[model samples]
Target: MRRYAEVKTANMLMAVELSRRSKGQLRSYSLHPGMVATNTVDKEALWPAFRQLDIVTSDMKPKENGFERWKTIPQGATTTVVAAFDPRLDDKAGTYLVDGNIAMKEQVASHAVDPVCCLLLE
Candidate 1:
């Protein structure tokens, strides 16, 4: 999932750049909808692919705690809906959201919002 993280970082960087360059003409955001139970992934193929990478999933089972549970489709769509229409975000362009809310500073990586890192990506 390293590649996935890389792509997510890039996506947020683009949002920042676009929002800055366009000023008030544009608003952009990046968000992580919580892990949702989707049928899009082919479950049978995922295990073998993980095996090929020597990934040990024995200890990677789903968390049964109050957190880390998968959401249904509707539940997972909450963030997207909020990002698109929430008046509370009127002044919060280029933000990264998690679980339908603005992510706390501690939740984001420093480099993910750094202009130097954005330039390095070019």
Candidate 2:
């Protein structure tokens, strides 16, 4: 997934550059949705393992194993929807966002968006 994100970031940067060369006619952004609680993951598999990890959960909540906590699907979509439609982002093209804010801890992703990486990606 880390490698996938790195490559995806490079591609996004390339698109942003292309958009920029289009003379302000296009927009692009990279958005990260936090861990979301969805039904796609096999809850049955996670349930048995949670007990070993000392994770206690009630049956009412879905177990999303990879992260400390899970956001509802709508909650996870906040950043993506914002990136897609927010007028405030008119000047924020090529920005990498997480949770509807700039992502500051994304060293690998930042490097992927660098000019050299963008060129290679081209």
The deviation in Å at residue 33 for candidate 1 is 0.4
- Native-referenced Cα lDDT, model 2: 0.66
Q: Per-residue lDDT tens digits of candidate 2, residues 21-118?
A: 66666777776786676763446756655444433355535445635567888999999999888898887677777788766764334575565656
Rate residue 12 of model 2 by lDDT.
Answer: 67
Full-model lDDT, candidate 1: 0.76
Give one digit per residue, the lDDT tens place, for model 1 in 14-108: 87777777885787889989867565333665654444444324443333342456678999999999999999998888899998999999989
Best by TM-score: 1
Report the number of the highest-lDDT candidate. Answer: 1
Task: Report the backbone clash tally of model 1.
Answer: 0
- TM-score per prediction, in order, is 0.79, 0.67
